[model samples]
Target: MPERELTFAQAVREALAEEMRRDSHVCIFGEDVAEAGTPFKVLSGLVEEFGGDRVVDTPISEAGFTGVAVGAAMTGMRPVVDIMFGDFLTLTMDQMVNQAAKVHYMSGGHWKVPMVMRTTLGATRRSAAQHSQSLHAWFSHVPGLKVVLPSTPYDAKGLLKTAIRDENPVVFFEDKMMYKLKGPVPEEEYTIPLGVAEVKREGDDITIVATSSMVQVGLGAATLLEKEGISAEVIDPRTTWPLDDKTLIESAKKTSRVIVLDEGYGRYGVTAELAAVIAEGAFYDLDAPVKRMGAMHVPIPFSPPLEDVTVATEETVFEAARQLCGKT
Candidate 1:
C-alpha cells in the first residue's frame, strides 16, 4: 500500500475512526463531537459514520461526563472522552485522579479503567487562560494516569491507538498549534508504544529535551546552534507519564549538559520533573546545572506579542541552550 501524509488533526481522526471500527466497545463522548466535531475537528464526520450511539455528544458538564465515562469504562466499554481544553481537565479531576486513575490499583488488579482522555494544550492564537494551558505535568504527577504527548503526526496517531488499546487510563494531550502541522504517517495501521523517546536530532555539546510544541522550538534551536559550531542533541519523550528517562539521561550524560523546555509553567512542571530526573540519575555526567525554559508563571495573555514572550519559542530554547553551553 502507498503511504500518505496527513495533518496532525487528520491522523487523530483516523486513529479514532479505525479503533471504533475494530472494537465494538470503543465509543467516544465529548461536547461538540457530534456536530462541531471538536474545536480542531478531530471528530469531524465521526458521528455520521459511527452513529450517535457510539460517537456521543455530551453537555458542557465536564465533571459529570467524566464520571459517567469512568463508570462506563469500569463496567465494560472503552470510552474516549474529550475535554476540549487541557485547562478544563481540572474540572474533572475527581473522576480522573480519584476514580479513573486509581480504579485498577484500588481494585487490586481486578479491574482497570481503560479510558483515553483527549485534550489540547498550547498557547497559540491567544486562547487565553481558561483555554490555553499545558497540564500534562499535573496528570503525570498523579500515580494512575498515563500521559502521552506526541510531537509528530505519526506519533500522534500511533500513541493514541496505543492509549485506546492499553489496559490503563491514558491522558493524551495534543497541541492546538500542531493540529495543522503536516507530516508523513503510515497508510496502514500502526501503534507507537508508550514510554519510548525519539532522538529527533543528534549532536554532542548539549542535550535538549522537550515535549509538545517545545519539540519544534528545540529542533529550530538545534539548527541555529549548529550554525554556531555547537552540536545539540534533541530528544522528545513522546509520552510524559511513562517517560523514557533512560534515553533522556543517557543523552544528557553523553553531552554532559542539558536544556529542558516545556509549554507549561516552569515551577513544578514537566521541565522541572525532567530536570530532577536528570539531576538524580546522571548527576556525575553533568558539567553544569541543567537549565529549563518554559512559559512565564502567568495566564496566557491575549496580546500576540505578550503571548509570544510568555510562551516557549525558538529564541527561548536557543538562549537557554547557549547559557548551558557557557556561550551566554
Candidate 2:
C-alpha cells in the first residue's frame, strides 16, 4: 500500500477526531473552534461531527477557558484547551503551573488532571511579538506537566493521542508556520510515548539534538555537513519534560560533539537543559563543549529581515556544527 501523506494540521485534526470518537470524554475548548475551526482551521468540521457541546467555542479569554478546562478535567472530562497564540501562554501560566500541575501531588495522587493545552509557536507570519513565542520551556520546568513539541505530521498525530490519554496535564506546542508541512502519516492507529527521543538521521561525527521545529533545520544542516565529509546525527526529543536523557547521552557519547537547538530563547531555555544533560552524561568522552542555538533573545520582530535573523536556520546549524567539528 502506498504511504498516505497528511499535512501537520490535518494530522492534528485526525488525532483529535479519532480520540473524540474513541472516548466521549475528549472535548475541545477555544475561540471560534466550534464553527470557525480556529484561524488555522485545523478543527474545521469537527463541531459538525461531535456537536457544539463537546467542540465548544469559548469567549476571547485565555485564562477563563483554561481555568474551565482545568475544572472539567478534574471532574472527569479530558478537556483539550486551545490557546490561540503561544505568547498568550503567559495568561494561563498560573492555572497550568499551580492548579493543574500540583493537583495530583497535593491530593497525594488521589486526583488526576487529564488535561491538554494545544497552542502554536514559531514566527515569520508577521504576527509580531505578541503572537509569536515558543514558551514550552516554562511548562517543562514544572514538576508534573508534560511538554510535547511535535515536528512532523506523524509525530503531531501520535504524540497528541498519547497526551490526550495521559493521566497528567500536558502542554502541546505546534509550529504555526508548519501547519501546512507535508509528511507521511499512517492511517492505522498509533501513539508515540512522551519523553522518548527519535534519531532522524544517524551519524558518527556529531550529534544535533533539536526540539520542535528545529528538528527539520537540524536535518537540513546534517545534509549540508554530509556533503562536506562531516557526519551529523539528528535527534528529536519529542517531549521536553519527561526527556529521554539516555538516548541523547548515548548519541553524544558516540559522536563526541553535540549542538542543542530549539526555537525558544537561548538563555535559560530548552537548549541549555539539553546541553547540560549531554554534558552530565558523557563528560568523560568529549570533543568540544555542547553549543546551543535558538531564537535571538528579544521580542520576535515583524520585519522580514529582522525576523529572518532571529530564528535558527539550516545554514546557521550547518555552520555551527562545522565549526564544532573543526571543519571551518
Task: Sum up the clashes in candidate 2.
Answer: 0
Off by over 4 Å in 2: none
> Candidate 2, 239: how far from true, in Å?
0.4
Give me the candidate number with maximum TM-score. Answer: 2
Model 1 lDDT per residue over 205-262, tens place: 9999989889999999999999878899999999888989999999989999999988
Pull out the clashing pairs in model 1.
none
In candidate 1, where is summed lDDT lowest over 10 consecutive residues?
312-321
lDDT of 2 by residue, 1-328 (tens): 8899999999999999999999999999999999899999999989999999999999898888999999999999999999989999999988999999999999999988999999999877888999889988899899999999999999999999999999999999999989999999998999999989999999999999998889999999999999999999999999998999999999999999999999999999999999999999999887999999989999999998998899899999999999999976
Q: Given candidate 1, what's the lDDT at residue 294?
A: 74
Steric overlap count per candidate? 0, 0
TM-score of 1: 0.98
Give the Cα-based TM-score of candidate 2 against the true structure. Answer: 0.99
